[model samples]
Target: MKLTLIFLIMISFLSGCNKSENDEKPEKKELELKSKEVLEATDRFGWELLQAVNKEADPGQNVVISSLSVAQALGMTTNGAANETLSQMLDVMDFGEVSEMNEAFHNIREVLQTADPKVQVDIANSVWYRQGMPAKESFGEALEEDYDAAFREVDFSKKQEAKDLINGWVNDKTKGKIPSIVDEISAGQYMFLINAVYFLGKWQYEFDKSATKDEDFTLSDGSTMQVPMMNQETDLDFYSGEDCQAVKLPYGDGSFYMVIALPANGIELDEFINSLDTNKWSTITDNMHERGLALFMPRFEVECKFKLNQTLIDMGMELPFSEFGADFSNMTEAQVFIDEVMHKTYIKADEEGTEAAAVTSVSVVVTSVGGGGPMPFRIDRPFFFAIAEEESDAILFSGKIENPKQ
Candidate 1:
């Protein structure tokens, strides 16, 4: 018998913005920068998540995560989280209060949406639920107003049709890079909170395609494999720190870029990762200087599809996932708890530039809960990566490419 996996999907896209715009006055920009607390909190949250997920990553496997996407989805869900469940979720995300957290997300999203006219950056949020299981007005309004999420009701019992509708939205938003994010609507799943981000941009300094060649890449197991490697030499922001060497490769107008962190010689990748925090990352980025360097990066495409339940738990977000411990009463009158947090990502880095897409689904099963840097001087061995916006330093996506061939 053919198995049909059922699940709820929360569809999100990166090309848009939350309807509620944040203060964008010049004075406000200065204030936002001076008050580094928001940046610190967001970076701290991303770092903690990277470490937690990295610990669970398979040895020598490629791991990619859109922390911004995941955080946005959970932050929207947090609007419905209350009391201890809300407190635990906030603590894990490093936010002092819910109001502060919402504003931070708002500001970050606003900056990203308006960052560039050449680069396609869209962010979208939505709520999908089964018919007759309508979300509470208050909860719905909070998501619709604050998060700028669209809501839709469907008969999830028609799993195939529902899957198509949900996946089609994802495909359209990501330009078909991520064709589908959900396979089936599993029983007991009542609602989903989805956040999707899609980005396509050309490098400020494109590499010479004729110069691309298959080169040897040393794997973690001390073995080598030949991969199509792209080479370039240019003036870019570079940093050499005690733990790692870093480089920033800008996309389009330079408001967005890729930061690669290569661990210093003799330092293990895991050790370098564990040593990262918001403060350290801020210092590293601030200290980078314009310098010329010869860079060789692999021309590769990779994807990761996994459930983040265990990872979130390990990061101290247990209450939201616990059926008994969860308290998402604001989302609906019915008792609900988070059953799973599903994430999917597609990324490609070639001679021209980089394109990436991510979709995160936070499933509320009648109970549920929710929810880095470079030194690249060469990424031949395992190295950490983060695609971010410069002005706000908002991390859009991050991961370690253990083996591009994977």
Candidate 2:
């Protein structure tokens, strides 16, 4: 199937602060579209987030974005004929020059293969590769798995089995740090179609046992709760906003960042969440000027699973995957339509904190750390977080921490 991530340049104004925005369209709008479908997938949730997965902020910058699609990728190849929705999506995917990178492609294959002797990955995008032929060959070889229907079309009706398969792959890929994949899937017309899954996580310098302690969590809507808070008193880039305050905690060798959001008092939980917008996100990102600040957050983790069917319906994207309105003929012999799309994610943070996992279909990878902080923002009630590349502002991971110890 085809996948797209179109991160268009969007602009908005925060409530109080009229943040200056860069509306000047980039001279080079070199965006690849099939990926756009994948990027807009998050429109279902205002608070939901998907960002870039850049290497650390140190010297040699490396990036890794992993995506597992279970739909059109297999829809057009298998099934009564793979799903056309996914097939048409992939029609324009550019493989670029990655087909040339033999060594690098081999290494990628080794990593994925060494990781899963059972499951195989197939990459078919016409995307460009900058590292010349070696890198191209690496990608090509890494994606050289023929269709056998094992990891091909997913049996959505067999939900548990579906979860098991994806969880297995994600668990292996994340080195057990995260398990962000479901076992099965189902499309109305087809009992078994394709699916896409992804998982990513990083340890920002393992938390010291002595640093965690019980603390108070003040949520919006005037509610206060007690929760374990992770205390790491280090200098960092901090923002104290009128609507909501935020703290950027560096993570892993400095490639990505973990940004925590604590809403202002008197703000209702639903109200605050409802108020979420690109402008709010933009405000937080633009205010990311590195500043010396201390930080502390409740040591808590949460596991949340959401059936995004209705959520997607609520978003403006009800056109492609709708029951009566979907148009996916390019993928299969049948008029393939999107039956439903589901999502489940989990995260835990405590004294020896911050452990989380999620399951979904898409691409992204991030782990950054090259800054400072000692910020204290308990997330007892509800707060937002994101895994992002500090340099480019591309967010790879984003979620809300409602219950700290849950």
Best by lDDT: 1
Instruction: Give one digit per residue, the lDDT tens place, for model 2 in 221-278.
Output: 3567777665555456667788788877655445455777777877644445456555
Please list the C-alpha lDDT of all candidates, in the order they appear: 0.79, 0.40
Residue 251 Cα positional deviation in candidate 2, in Å, after optimal superposition:
1.0
How far residue 335's Cα lies from its native spot in candidate 1, in Å, is 1.0
TM-score of each: 0.87, 0.56
Separately for all candidates shown, the number of backbone clashes (residues 3 or more apart, or on different chains) is: 36, 103
Stretches of candidate 1 exceeding 4 Å from the true structure: 1-39, 367-377
